[model samples]
Target chain A: MFNEKIVNPNELRHWEGRIELYWIYTSGEAGDRFFKALKDEEKFIAAKCKKCGKVYFPPRMYCEFDFSETEYVEVSGEGSVRAFTVARLDKDEKPLEKPEIYAIIDMDGTDGCMVHLLGEVEPEDVYIGMKVKPVLKERGEREGKITDILYFKPS
Target chain B: MSVGKKDISCPPEAPGTPLKDSDIKEKKVTYVEDHPDMRYAWTAGQAISRFLNELKEGKLIATKCNKCRRILFPPRIFCELCYKPIDDWVYVQDTGTVQTFSISYIDPDARPLKEPIIVAVIAVDGASKNMAFMHVLGEVEPEDVYIGMRVKAVWKPEEEREGSVTDIKYWKPMEK
Candidate 1:
């Protein structure tokens, strides 16, 4: 404080400026296909087990009970919101830039669930079993991903 | 080859420079001093484990329950029904059928290993349904492996034998 930083090392710029950054995220399968159908072709896919006759929402390869292979199935993006919650943190448990509504949409007539973002609702109004449909992302603006629909709202 | 023998002499290795990658492996080694040691010996089930152990010596093994009169493979150490301890051993062929398996592109630690390996669960001829062992598979494409395909052990050279499962190298399709 007494030396006044010695004229700041005699440089015009004293700090590093901002720069854009990017990264490639490779989601194993469910995440990969969810966005693929949503953005690229506007589709939703799920895995169905042929032996057990039960389907999984997140999708899996083997049946934990008997260790059998799971059959893949394409789901019609139509469904209703079974349960919803507000997610304020990222997967890393860090505060996200913007809070989003996460809903477990019980797919239409299927014994399964799909967790996605919910839009156009206040905090107090999201009920346990509300009817909702997938608001698909426009084809022109789509990129084959979960972000395509933007968020699930009232059908 | 001797089992766990420590009498052999060894030569000194030449010292080398540091390696590029120095990742450490984590193998949990634990011991219980306060509690009594849980001992398990194949002697009671001589008809099973004995023969399986002798396979390293190029022999097969099996056992029959005196009470039930059933030929048990992999050497059943006890009568599963009556709960009485078993005490016989017999021999069986190394030949077995492949149950199911995955071509692991990743290693045990979830890392990309040197090359893709075929890890399989093979059901031995004398073993019961779903009875299998985890072993390396080879000599065919990953897609060629089927649930019921026959496979046999391809042993390593005799001089390289260490009386361990690794001595069998990897299993390959048996000649039809």
Candidate 2:
């Protein structure tokens, strides 16, 4: 028999567990460059690994393999959608207004791709191996930022 | 009385010795998931939360180490040095400069924001390599903010303040 209750607990009304959090703050230069590439005609850019001559499409600052200084190279934003998923849930797993087609586009001259939103088509129509190109934003005063290119649609 | 020129007030008088650990209370937040925002809120210790809540009051406070003459922001009451309990308090200035910074086109929910948010790693007036503070930048062109650039707070109105870092509103460039 328990003396009253050793560790008697509620049915657990909410989330209970242990976790670690990493609070990350990023630099402005890297961030501006990232969005700029996305805005300007979807030209994919990769940071060249100064060591092994390998290029990273997602654009890493230091070489993953050798920690060497990397440089940026704008690659052809045109490519086939390598892999993708339909995002039915928000970042917190809550449902979204309208679903989005998230895809990885493998650009020419780069080893990998730039993941972005694919629009202008029904969700069911999106498929693996779809060929697409970046839809650049209109001309005027582009601060060379992202969203300069609107959204990636059938192109 | 002067630490140096440049209008910085005389170095604050150093406090002597640390309080014995017998003074601290044993308390912590209930760490859990399924918040309206975070999948979970990481449970932090009593000292840490006290530091954060103080920020809500629009005050900058850090734990002081009487043993090593060090001040820690995001205040921890235990001295990482000397292996002693920190047990003291020191208020910090809101002024700081960009140590390193980045702008994000996404919000806390990871959704694309209508306008990009300017976030930065501002090294406050008194701290070390790991002591850079995280906050928002405003009133200056995103292009103008750079590494090592100086900035100060554009505090939220006193009446509206709730004692959080957000009460400062954003950091603005200190014109040279």
Candidate 3:
């Protein structure tokens, strides 16, 4: 019943397809307040658990430990570097023209930390426990994203 | 353990403030946009390889199952009903009868189109009963196209064909 066989691999056919897609992500409840405050007032906010007093940076609506509701509070947006790394390659595995320094900054008034790029200093000069403060974009150019704060530099 | 504990009670209003769609449009809240480059290559195996090759030559081909005496369009190597290899390749008529159709006013992305397009499931003339494939209709008004309407394939010029489904420009109303 079966008759034809394509012995040469080149005789087989193939079709090209692509997924042309774009996506938008909304920063949820606590994020809306946090990013808005940063973009509008140049202020930082943290969420504190109404029950246990644990504070969260990049604020959230509820406490992770006990699931209690949380409320927003203002912070100074200054912190100390807890850890650091130097990245020499871009996401596509190509060598970057300039290496970037990134760090996990432990926010001063919260029990939470944020990972962000380091600026205005050389990679060799960065160290753990170095004080750093956020550098925001020009007032008229802010977009209310994490990128609104351009990077962190030694205060 | 409770040394620093203070009185705690649930409040009527929850902590989070909800924003509306306008908030996003007016830049009242933050959002992120991302795009990724993704691609794929689909192999057209045994049956489809021959079918597409025939289509490139301005012909339509199908498979026949001896057990069921059925000719299947969009041909497959195995008969689904009998669970056996198909017995032969058969050429079907480029002409078909429209089984059902729709007038689409929107494009694939839900954007409005200036001119409505008629799309239909057409039962090829020489294939087994109710064996139909989806294709767009052309050269006829949306109001005039209906079920049981006879149609014929409108092929692109041989030099311009690239062995894809679009090789057939579209199906048009067949002349009596």
Candidate 4:
């Protein structure tokens, strides 16, 4: 038989540590095409399955449902706001100086939608099914990133 | 008319270009990078809670299991092997022997440090054989550190003491 003694609550201890590392992401095959087109030509490209005729924004090399190869197709990049939210806090839960409006935009010619920030519009004015177009970064300042298409503005 | 891989067919258009490493280096392919900041607080439960408190007082402690007769350093409340609660807390010497060591030229982030650091696993005195905890070895040259070298803890000033492994500034070579 063992006897146990209660410890004082004030004596509990804890240690602190932080995850301090950076990550490098590689855009894959279809992403490579989509980003390169957006970066160099300021064009939007989506993948289309010939068999099902389903087009995907943020394209992929293969179709998800049928597992078939897809072909690249140029798109106007205009889209409609499908859903949205206004974020007031950052990743660390710190309050932002200004709230940011983020939206899911359903691209005109694709079955998929892109989640991106909404610019040049007030949060209350945003609505589902509103027409919008991408406002790209200046050609000289453009990096091959999603940020190259800065945000979606009312077209 | 078939299902699975046998029925899958590709479109007539060509797939996207697969870039070589040179293409990426030449800015042909586009990519993005991001850094995420994450933090955590870990609780030093039952046994280690007391052990760390003892460390703050400039003492070393261990938990002993009566059945297995094994004294564990960095003490735990329960014996993992015997699957029972530890019998008692034992005060151990602040002395230990270096089990293994490494001379690190870089910090945890892989960046070079101004002066290299020597870290080691020290098998604490009075604990069962081979039970060790990692700590930095200081007050001795890197070349002088060796396996089986006896060392003693150098504690922080009483006023500076906090219940942490860092309470012990570092371990130094024991005088002959």
Candidate 5:
């Protein structure tokens, strides 16, 4: 008994498959508070350390520096761009219809920064240190998620 | 307001407003959902490639290891038991005997289904004893399925066939 090996490359086969699954993400305590504040009040909350008095934007329950309890304080959701980049391609490497500007925004009166999309201004005009404010969705449309703030635009 | 110099003591309880799942669903809290589309491909090596191709043509194929005299279904190029290359490709009967079976009331994700499905390990005829493969069973009640029950392949129509294991739609109990 003898077996013949498949010699032609065209005769070889491969099976196609996919990761047919999804993920559910839950916002923890700090994130829940921060986003709820943004959604309900259109304001931002920072966690101020009871021990060291460091104010953390995107509020946390415990201070990162000294591991002390923190208290929430409200602030206007305004910031300045610390750094920026222009993205001509999306995550899949496909070219976008319009290039998007992304920036690290240093929040006013806090020691933290957030990376978010910048809109309503030309990418070439987006300088570092430019003052910007969050443009939130209509109150009725807000879903308490980060996208509730549509983007940051120069104020 | 600045804290006084003497005002530093570890609070007995941590400061966080615990939220329940109801809070999230009721729009009392915030969350995000993300879905990414990822895909993959697996190469069916020499033996199984031929096996799948034969299935697309509405046939069952197997490989025989002359050294161990064992017939391998869902054919493999090499025999694990004899540690040698299989000697020949052989066509096996589309009929088989059920080795074991289960009635599943839940889907793959563990969600309950309105109707149950019967799945079985079937030892294909013309293959070595115990050379069985897993497949779903149809046209039979869960109570009627038992070990050693004879079954036959139910294939999809020819034009609809893809060179995959699913080319055979399922295995059904054979007529007496």
Candidate 6:
């Protein structure tokens, strides 16, 4: 038999700790191509599966369904909004000074889409299937990251 | 048709420009870095709750199992090996022997500290053999800490007690 004791609810104890660390992400093979082209030439690249002819935006080294190696192909960084939302809160759940519009853009010439911030348009004016083009940072200030494209503006 | 293997070839691009480590260093490929801000609260259960309360009173407490006759430090309500409930709580001496130690030049975040800190696993005197817990060491040189060295807990003033493991600021060498 297990011995039990009645403890007052007020006597419960807890310890406090914090998680503190910085993370560094490396761009893999397909990521390397996509980022490099954006930084150097302001170009957008997609992965094309040679066997199934499926095009993937935000390219990966291999096709997810067929497990076949993919080749990089250039595509216009313009698409239509498939869906969108307005975010009024920060990461900490505090309201932001200005609300931000985010959308899933279905990239042209590829069977893939990317989620990024939509700008240069009002939230009330944004509509599904609205055509959009990427607004990249200035050439000299470009970094090999997704932020290289500041936001998507109506085109 | 069984799906096993199929011959597939990727489309060829212009020869050259293979990604390598040099590309990263030369800023050919870019990446992102982020630090997450997070905090957590862990509940100290029945056994540790009492142990911490005893620490606030400047005393060390342990639990004893009648079946194995072993005193467990960082006290637990149940005996893991014997599969029986601990019979009673017992007082242990504040003094312990160093089982192993390390001289750490970096803090928990991997950042270099101004002065290196010495940390050790100390086996308490009244507990079962090889039963130890981690604590920082002080009032001694890094080179002087060794296995089986006697040490005593250096408690903070009673008025400053917070019922936490840190109630004992650090352990110091106990003069025999």
- The prediction achieving the highest DockQ against the true structure is 3
Q: How well is candidate 3 docked (DockQ)?
A: 0.34
lDDT for each residue of candidate 4 in B15-133, tens digit (9 for 90 to 100): 55666778656766676666878877677777888888887889989999999999989888889999989898998888999999999999999999998999999999999987899
When summed lDDT is taken over every stretch of 10 residues in candidate 6 chain A, the lowest stretch is: A1-10
Q: Model 2, range B1-176, lDDT digits (tens) per residue?
A: 64754432332443433433242222111111232333443434545556656666777778777777777876775777778777577787888888888889999999998878799988887654467778999887778879988999888877887655678889998985
Clash list (residue pairs), candidate 3: none
For model 6, the stretches where C-alpha displacement exceeds 4 angstroms are A1-20, B1-23, B37-51, B54-176
- In candidate 3 the C-alpha lDDT for residue A26 amounts to 88
How far does residue B168 in candidate 4 sit from its true spot (Å)? 15
- Per residue, candidate 1 scores C-alpha lDDT tens digits across B132-157 of 67788888788788888899888878
Top-scoring candidate (TM-score):
4
Give per-residue CA lDDT, model 6, range A48-86, as digits (tens).
987788999989878877767789999999999999999
Instruction: At residue B18, give the lDDT of candidate 6.
Output: 60
CAPRI verdict (incorrect, acceptable, medium, high) for model 1: incorrect
Sequence-dependent TM-score of model 5: 0.54
Write down the RMSD of all candidates, one decimal each: 28.8, 26.6, 9.8, 9.9, 9.8, 10.0
Ten-residue segment with the worst summed lDDT in candidate 3 chain B?
Answer: B6-15
- Write down the TM-score of every candidate: 0.36, 0.40, 0.53, 0.56, 0.54, 0.55
> Which ranges in model 5 have alpha carbons more than 4 Å from their true place?
A1-12, A16-20, B1-21, B35-39, B45-176
Clash count list over all predictions = 19, 12, 0, 0, 0, 0
lDDT of 3 by residue, B1-176 (tens): 76775555545566556668798678766799889888876778888888888888999999999999999998999898999899999999999999999999999999999999898999998999978898999999998898999999999999988788889888999863
Candidate 2, position B81, lDDT = 75
Share of the reference A-B contacts seen in candidate 3? 0.77
What is candidate 5's lDDT per residue for B29-71, written digit by digit as tens? 5666668788766677788778888999999999988899989
DockQ each candidate and list the results. Answer: 0.00, 0.01, 0.34, 0.33, 0.30, 0.31
Quick one: how many clashes does candidate 4 have?
0
- Candidate 3 at A46: error in angstroms? 0.5
